[model samples]
Target: MARRGGDDRTLDLLAWQPPEPQRYAEERVRTATLRDRISRAVSETLKDCEQTRADVARAMGEWLGEDVSENMLNAYASQGREEHTIPYLRLLALVQVTGDTRLLQLGAELFDTTVIENRLKPFIEIGMRFDRRNRAVAIAQEEDREIDVAIRTIRKGARQ
Candidate 1:
């Protein structure tokens, strides 16, 4: 479609049709479960981290005030060891040691909640405030319509 300025290369958003919702649901089912994904995530974080597994274990142990061994880390990273999923507190310690906050975000996504970074809090707050203001405006408009209807009913009765 040509733009107002006569450029023929611009795409028109008004012509776009959204994909069917079933497509999205099927895609979700195609993905791995949360348990397997978390195992992969732990392995990936360990692989990408600058610290050695033992060093991470030691740091995590110190953070948790409990013994977190290399074997425990190994089990957490292994997909076959489903029975050995890491506990929440130990996961937090691991996150602290490796600085991989995405591990925390993975769980939050399942609940349809966001894990906001401290730096982005102000920006998110502004968006939330706008959402609240828009809802308030919609509610006020609805109340105004009801008030107008009631006033018209009373005025009509008085005239009769």
Candidate 2:
């Protein structure tokens, strides 16, 4: 039998063959591209609809009993729920008219940070007392320390 070299030429030639480029299947690429476009379109449509809804809500609030600017009204109306419930809409309007981002942010933060709930407890109590059904007494009560603190903070920041 003929002796063969440890590194065989024939084996090296076979191993040297170039690998074929991986081809993405046409159907998968097309489907993914189409899905992405549809998702983008839906997002844009929702944004536009939200802006329009906010404009309408702000207009309605102005017609009610507040000298609410469009910007403030829009901000309040933008917070509305899709369910279109009257009470929820009213709450958004109240929040906007009051320009109380502190309360809004505090409410959201309370759910995330337990310590914030403690800081917010007094304010929440005052707010509950003042809700639509009990506005008269809520308003008549002595000045709210917690609310005063919040308003002062807002004013201080605005001046800066």
Clash count, one per candidate = 0, 0
Clashes of 2: 0
lDDT (tens digit, per residue) of candidate 1 on 24-114: 1223223367787777778877887999999999999999999999999999988889998889999999989988776776777678776
Model 2 Cα shift for residue 25 (angstroms): 33
Candidate 2 local accuracy as lDDT? 0.44
TM-score of each: 0.72, 0.18
**Highest TM-score against the true fold, candidate:** 1
TM-score of 1: 0.72
Clashing pairs in 1: none
Give me the runs in candidate 1 sitting further than 4 Å from their true place. 1-33
The residue-level lDDT of candidate 2 at 25 comes to 30
Residue pairs clashing, model 2:
none
